[model samples]
Structures are given as C-alpha cells and as structure tokens.
Target: MSCSIKPVYGAQHPPLQVMPKGKEERSKTSNKRDAFQDFENNTSDAWDDGDDDLLVMANIQMSLRDVRSTAQAVMENHSKQLSAQNQQTSSVKDELRKLSWSGIPKPVRATAWKILSGYLPASLDRREPTLQRKRHEYFGFIEQYYDTRHQEIHQDTFRQQHLGLGTILKDIPRMTSLAHLFQQKVVQEIFERILYIWAIRHPASGYVQGINDLVTPFFVVFLSEFIDNDVESENFDLCQLPQETLNIIEADSFWCTSRLLDGIQDNYTFAQPGIQMKVNALKELIKRIDVPLYKHLEEHCVEFLQFSFRWMNNILMREIPLRCTIRLWDTYQAEQNGFADFHLYVCAAFLVRFTQDVLREQDFQGILMFLQNLPTHHWQNEEIGELLAEAYKLKFMFADAPNHLSKKK
Candidate 1:
C-alpha cells in the first residue's frame, strides 16, 4: 500500500491573515472569509498529520470476544505446536509428535516458533571466546551444562545471588531517590538481578545487551507491585532463604525465561531481520491507512524501522518514561499473541497522529532522532488500547491459516 498524496519535500504552508469586519453585510462577508481560511488551514493540518481521515476511519471490527476466542484457540493449539517445536529435546521430543496430529496450522505454529526461538539465541549455548565470567560463576557445572529443563531454577538462584537478600534490602530506598547512588549501586544491582533472571532462565540465550533495556519495565512494575510500601523501608529483602537457592537450582527458572524470551528473541538478533520485518509491516499498514505520511517518509528515505529499531526491540522502554513504558509492556505481556503486531499498530498510530512534528524532519537520521525523542503525546488510554486491539485484528491480514476446506471436500 502507498500514500495518495503528491510528493512534497520541505513544503511550506502559506500564511493566512484574518481581515477585520466592516458593518452589517460587509462584516458578515469578512467573517465568512476568515472562517473559510481557518477551515482550510485545519484541513491542511489534518492532512499533513494524516490524522483527519483516519480519526473518523472505521475501526477493524475486532471485538474482545474475538480476541478471547482466537487467543484461547491459539493457546490450545500452541501447546501442540510448542511440543512439536521442542521435538529436538532429548526426553521431551515426543511433545512435538503429539502436536503433529493436532489440526493447528503449520505456518501459524512456525510463526510462533520463529518468534519464540529468537529469545534463545545461539550465543547462549556457545561459550564466549573471551574470559569474561558471567554471574553464574558460583554454580560452575550448572551454568556450563545449562539447558531448557533447568532454566527456571537457574533464574531464581541467579536472582538471589546477584540481586541478593542484602542488595535488594539496600535498593529499596533508591527506588524513590532515582539518584546517583540509586542508579549506580541500587538500580544497577537490581538491573543485574533482572538481567540474570533473564539470562539464567534463558541460559540458551544468556545475557544480551538490549535485553536489559527490554526487561526494565518488567522489573519496575514487579518491584512496585511486590515491594509496595516497603520500597522506602531500609530492610526490604526479596530473597529470604538460602534453601530457596537450591530449590531454584532444581526448578528450571532458566527454562521459564527461555519460554518467555522466545517470543521476543528477534529483537536481540544482530542481523536485524525481525526489526526489518516489523518496519516493513508497519510501512505496509500505514500506506493503506495514511498515504501522505507514508509518502513523506519514503520521499525523505525515512524507513520506519530506522527509528523503530529501539522501540520494537525494547518496546519503548529506552525512549519513553517508565510510567508509559510499563503500561505498554503490561498490554504486550497480557496479549502475548506475538506482541509484534500491537507494537506495529502503536507505531502507525504515532506516525499518523503525530505527523506534523515527525514529518518536519528533513532526512532519515533526523526522522529517526525525531521518533527516538517522540514524547508521550496527549493520547487517551482508550485510543492506545484501541490501537493495540486493531493490531491484533490486523494479524489475519498477515498470517496464513492452514487449509481445512480441501481436506473436508
């Protein structure tokens, strides 16, 4: 899909001057002219922003019922798909065989696999050539032999070790300070614990740079929820027992994070294929809905992903404030039918709705910087939720379902 607007580069708007009204009919005529000019300016602004037409555009008719039904069915089918996906596992490979008999679409399953596999990168398995010791240095053998089965346990221990009963206790005061001591010692410590939670749980994917950014909101939210009033208290230990550490070692903390990370692995991939796919998808969606902004971006060589890379990778955590970023994360985590689609819709909504400031950029880099610096504009919660719902609604447009009619016939 492409924009309907003519290509305009660095276009300037003509200034309109309001004229004073004379008496009676003359005054009425002057007022009319002023009103017409104002209306024209408003129309132009709307077009420039790409918001006018789309604001009133009919939403993709997706109901909560539809999302629930689809998600439930997808989850049921996903169990089989996941079993198939994990077929290569030594003991649990049979899970895949069971799913092979299920009626789930292979392509849909494959998409899930693609997204899930990303969270567990090859780097997790291969030891680093350099001798940079990881946090799991304490449990040498378990770290060395880490696999999907013991991930959750590994993560719990990793959290206890790094985040520690002591550090977590100390870190509570820092949450409010948001200061240097807080950022450096406390925030960094907690971040390490969170990263290790991801890393140990995803020993297969291990610690990646961007992941810390991705999980920041989760940590922030979890801390707020779990810590509650005790966040300001001097003694707020998250881990209570050393026995818990042994239990973590046994329970597969690493595997759980791996499963969670699987959906978002593409974000951490160095090759950027996932990012490109998302940008292309957003561009396609925007072109159909808002031609002018699409054309403006294309004309300026401002590919959507250039700026979107960070947002897609970390879901705006790096760019936006914690308050907004966490809310978006909540929706993404809650909706998990591949949060990729929802992210794309939000990107489009921002581009179309915030067109004026975004389009003023002269070059790709400028456009990127503009997007990177994009503030939390005054948008309604309902509208953001609608954009998310629309993203899920649009999934069918991109996803291909398995053919059932041919077999039925």
Candidate 2:
C-alpha cells in the first residue's frame, strides 16, 4: 500500500513553533517580578530618586498582580468547565471533547478517559454498574485464560503464551525504567499480568513489542485514583493497597488498553499495513504542510519509515516522556477515531515541529539521528498542549480533503 504524493496548490502554512523552554515557569508572578526588578536595576539611573520612581515601581507591581489574577481566573474557568461536564447525568461528550481537546484536569482524568475511550457509558446512571460488570468480566478472563498458560497439553497455546510473556517481560522494565512506580515489584507483576492477558485474548496481533507501553498511561491514570501523590515520580508502596483495589486498577487498565487497541489494531497485525499506510500518510502530510523539510529528507534519501515507524507503532510512547504521553492521549481519546485518524496529523505536526532542524541537517544520517534522539525528555503538559494545538490545526486543514493525500495518477 504505497502512498503517492500529490502537489499541494495553496500557500504553505507557517512552520510549526516549539513553545519556549520554561514558558510556563516564566509566566509565574515570582518570575515576572524578578524580571521586572532586573529591568528596574538595569535602568535605575534613568529614573529620578524621588516620588516618581516610587510611583513607577508601584504601577509595575500592580500590573504583575493583574497578570497573576488573569492567569488564575483562566485556570479556574477551565476547572469549572471540566467539573460541570463530568457531573452531568446525560452525555456531555461534545463538551468533554471541546474541553479535553486542550487538556483534561487531572482530578477527573480517569473518569473522563474511561468515558472518552468508550469503556464507560456517557450516562452517569449506567457508569457504576457498567464498571462493576466490566471489571468482573475481566477478572473472569483471568480465571479462565490466564491459568491455561502453563497447561502443556495444549503445546501450541503454551508456546504462544511463553513467547508473549517473554517479550512482555523484556519490554515492561524498559518501558518506564526511571518511573518510581514502575520500579516497584508489585507494579511490575501487575503490568505483566495485564500484558499477558491482553496478548492471549487478542490472538490476531498477539503481543507486539510496543503494546506494553500502551498500558502504562491507563495504569498510571487509574492508579492515581487510589494514591495521593504523583504516580510518575513519587515512590509509593503498592503493597499498602488492598488486593481488591489492585485488582480494580489492573482490570481497568486492561479493558481501557483493549478499547484503545481496538481502534488501531491493524498497526500491529501482519505486516502492520495500518502503520505503513499511516507513515506514508504522515509523509504526504508533511509534503503539504512543510515542503522544505520534506524536500530536505528527499535530497538526503531519508525515508519516512526509518524514523516514523516507531511514531505510528507506539503512538509516540517511545518518543516523549511518560507524563507527556499521558497528556497527549487526553486529546487522542477526545477526538473521533483519534488514535487512527488524528494521530496522522499529530505525527505530521510533530515532524514539522522540527522543520528548522530538519532543514539544517545536510546529510541522511544527521537528519535521522536528530529525529530519533529528539530532546523531549523535559517536555511537560504545556509543551504537549502546544503540540496538540498544531495537530488540530493540521487536521482542520487537510483531514477532509482526502484527495490531498490520495494516490497520484
């Protein structure tokens, strides 16, 4: 399924912009005050040592207070919007989609993700019963299929299970090695069971290497419901949690991962025709969105698959930090067929995000190396928000114009 690039006719959009490092921190009142003080000190000679200077400093401080007040109000408004939507008895999906397109507030993220992923019903009345039934059904799967992994009478099944567990075992520790929660033995065992159960159930794709990474976002988000601290960096004793609580987390992670994979399963199937097509789509998208970078790759003989295979395969779980991936998925779940459709635009937006860097690289190896080892380790929710904003803009421009990415004659 090769994708042919068609010439784009309209004026190219402006290059994607990276949000400046420490943009969020710099926006804080303390930092703004410090910056103002520095400015005052640097130009003190220009001001009179009198009442005028005092008045000028007071006005500057007042402006800083106003900035802080405005920022606080915006945050409060977003929080109110999320709370109102989640508390509704009927479907608030359209509102959720709009609010979630930017980002979901952490407190309601778990319930919001469940509803967005189709794991929980939109009606508040049905949600509790549906959760109970789904959780019980998932554990029943554990009782039935999980125990059969060791039954040697079914040699083929045993072999498949063995291989799946082997791969999952190899990948789980490496998935988020630095995350404190994942480093815990209890958490590792939970991940192992979730991956193994999911693999055995979905025989069609049967435990791809990158699938292990997909479970972490769901696991951490659900676990956050039980813990008080940050699940990403905070070290906590999973043993403190009761067995039933752990079971609930494990089951929820499994089913939510299932819902996510259901939309993009072809990305892991034989030959991964879905990812191949997506990678090609991403290339065509970039060709339209940023012509110079596309041409630079072409001139260097750099193929899209060389770098973007991991992007499509893991939905960029490998590229960005775990926290960033979680934030990115908030938008993914909110969009219709987000993982499969909007993700293409995200990849396009992400690639063009490095337009200047890509254009600066003169050779094939340089461009590939730069893209693979991108400096995203320090990226936070603010950066992820900017990325999603650009992705949405790209989706708006080209998603409806299928012929913009259609096969060339």
Q: TM-score, each model?
A: 0.46, 0.75
**C-alpha lDDT (0 to 100) for residue 383 of candidate 2:** 85
Best by TM-score: 2
> What do the candidate models score in CA lDDT, each in turn?
0.49, 0.82
At residue 4, candidate 2 shows an lDDT of 78
Tens digits of per-residue lDDT, candidate 1, 170-217, equal 433433323432344444544444444454444444455455455343
For model 2, how does the per-residue alpha-carbon lDDT over 1-409 read when each residue is reduced to its tens digit?
Answer: 9997654322232223245668745555355555555555556655556635654565464578888998999999999987886677334777788788778888999999998888998987888999999999988888887766676643476475445566777788888645677778888889888887887777777778888888989988898898886453346678989999999999999999999999999998878899999988988888887888888999999999999999998889889988888899988988899999999988888888888988888988899999998988899988888898898888888888889987667
Clashes of each: 19, 0
Relative to the unseen true structure, what is the Cα RMSD of model 1? 32.3
Q: Let me know the TM-score candidate 2 reaches against the reference structure.
A: 0.75
